[model samples]
Every structure is written in C-alpha cells, then in structure tokens.
Target: MRKSAALALAACVAVPAFARTDVGVSIGINEPGAYGRIDIGNFQPEVVYAQPVIIERSRYYENRTPVYLYVPVEQQQHWRRYCHVYRACGEPVYFVQEQWVEQRWREEHPGWRRHHRGWDRWDHDRGEHRGYGY
Candidate 1:
C-alpha cells in the first residue's frame, strides 16, 4: 500500500511536467497583427484621433517628438494599462488608423505572399534542407 501511494504521487507530479507546453510568435514592423512604433518618415499617416495621446505628463517628455504607433483599438482606448508594452508610457503617441496600416502594407508588399511561399515551407521544416528551401 505504501509503495502504491508513493508511485501515484510521483506520477501525478511527473505528468504535469511532461504536459507543459509553451508557444510564441513574433510579429515585426509593417506585418499584419504587429503592434509597435512605426516610422512615418516625410509622409503623414492617417490617425484614429486627431491629437496625440499622452498617458503621463512629465518635464522629460516636453521636448521629445511624438511617436507613431499601430496598436489594437482596445490598447489605444486603455493607454494607461498597456503603455509599458511599447515602452512609451510617458512619450506622446499618435495611434495610426487600422485602415491606413492595411493599405500601406498592401501597397508596399504587393508580391509578399507569392515571394514568401517557399520561405514559409522552409520555416515549417525547421531549417531542414528540403527541396522547398529558398
């Protein structure tokens, strides 16, 4: 009975260790579903709000130029809660409209899907040299 109880306890602890799983995906600038700073350059981007949103006011940010960001609508509405994610809690930020981001991505990456077809297969193979290697 003592051996059976100990084996059961060990199995309960070991099972969770083998069952744990973690997955992460990184989205970079100009990609769909990306959320971070965007370089507007000389051209002006359409923004969701006319004025820049300032979550925190401090003397340090007074002379700094405002940054443009492409964030989810929910994050924009709750800037105070999500500002730290972009590391712009105190800096002035202009949230670009989602429509503009989609348009710009389409214009800039017209052949992105076709060009990256083989790359996608290569990534799926986890760097194994298959015939689909780019």
Candidate 2:
C-alpha cells in the first residue's frame, strides 16, 4: 500500500521514476515570514522547505548580526515547491505577512550604525528533501 501511494504521488507530480515507499508532510512558521508554493503537475501543492528564523537577544554575541537558518517544508515524503525571498524589485527582501525589513533591523539590532543581515532560501521540494536557506 505504501509503495503504491508513493508511486502514485510521483506519477501525480510527473517525476522521474524512483524507488521509495511511504510519504508525509511538514511545515515551519518563523518571524519575518516569507512563503511560496510550487505546483507538481497540477497535483496538490506541498511545501518542501523553508528558512529557520528566530528572534532573541543576549549580552554576549553581537546583537547586530542577524540570525539566519534554513527550514524544511515537506509533504508526502517529497518536495513540491518553496517560497522565494519575498522582494519588491529594487526594494529590500522580506517574507510572508511582512514588509518593513529595515524597521525590523532597527528594532532588533538597535544602536547599530550599519549592519549587514540578509539571506536567500532554495528548494528542491522533491521527495522529502531537507531544503533550507538563511
């Protein structure tokens, strides 16, 4: 049953034949959220990966440096699509339900003259890939 299900999913996505069994899905939510989805042969769209983002402050490490991590979105033990770094052409990048990146920087990395913080996420979104970007 599991073998057929995985094969069915692959066929639905029109993916090259492979040997695998079992399938599943998962997702992650992070601040400065950015999200996107790609279609797999008109089948159900599934998230294959995402960026790992968290906000915290400490006296040790320089708070000025932005924290970045990769997150994985998956479904049916395969990847389907991923979110591109939300950007407005010449504008700075951002994520889902987001806009003011510069404002976030100021609030998070206060008292800093110029700080560099940014990243990009890539996705294979294929067969439960462990994809991430930051």
Candidate 3:
C-alpha cells in the first residue's frame, strides 16, 4: 500500500498539465470547504467511493428492477479474492471505486466485446471504434 500510494502520488505529480486547446467545457470542483479544480469536457464525470458490497453468490439484481449487473466469476482478480478473504476475517477494506469497470474495459479494448465472437467486430477500419462514434 505504501509503495502503491507513493507511486500514484509520483505519477500524478509527474503528469503534464497541457493547457486545454480544444473548445471544451470546464467544471469547477465541489467540496464542503475545499474547491475542486475545473474539469474540461462535454459532460461532467466523477466517481465516488461507495461501500464494498458482499454477496453470498455475488449475483444480486437491482432492488428496483431489470437493470441486472454482476461481478463476473472471471474477474475475481488475485487481489480481489485476497481482499474478500481479508474482509471475511473482519478486516476493513478500503478499495478503489469499482463503478463503470465494465465501461472502462470496453473503452480500453473496444475491439472485443464481452463473450461475443464472429457476428460482430469492433471495426477500427476508421482508426477508431464506430461504437465510440469517432
């Protein structure tokens, strides 16, 4: 954790803050006492650290309706399993926010969709995924 925190801090501090050159929107950071810096983009995007959810089967439907989501059995990364066991043993786990994990993976590897083959392809023939509307 110490190493990871240090590395993350170093990476953030090392980032090149290129002045925004494109015509973009900017959003100010919001906090109780501290102000957040401007975020430039078409839409405002942010993430909050929600509590870790545990599941006996890890298969829970939304309390409201058909918006079904799951933690794929294949996604139990080594660290995740370790954390699950650690928490089971009553240790507090402060994990990174896991929302939009599916979206993030899709964004990074748009060429491949989850569990699909042949009938569809992420056509990068235009040098970008048409799904991304480039």
Q: Clashes in each model (backbone N, CA, C under 3 Å)?
A: 0, 18, 1
TM-score of each: 0.60, 0.16, 0.24
Best by TM-score: 1
Residue-level error in angstroms, candidate 2, position 24: 30
Compose the digit string of candidate 2's lDDT tens values, residues 1-134. 99999998989787544534334322232233333321122222222224323222235334333222222334112221222332122221112222333344356656654433343223333446355542
Better-scoring candidate (TM-score), 1 or 3: 1
Flag the better candidate by lDDT, 1 or 2. 1
Candidate 1 lDDT tens digits, 9-120: 9999999889634323222356757778987655568898898899878887768898889999999999999999999988899998888887778777786652555556
Pitting candidate 1 against candidate 3, the one with the higher lDDT is 1
Ranked by lDDT, top first:
1, 3, 2
Candidate 2's error at 134, in angstroms?
A: 33
Per-residue lDDT of model 3, residues 1-134, tens digit only: 99999999988876755445455654332322222122334542323324333333233323422111122333323434543533331322223223434454456566755565755456635464567665
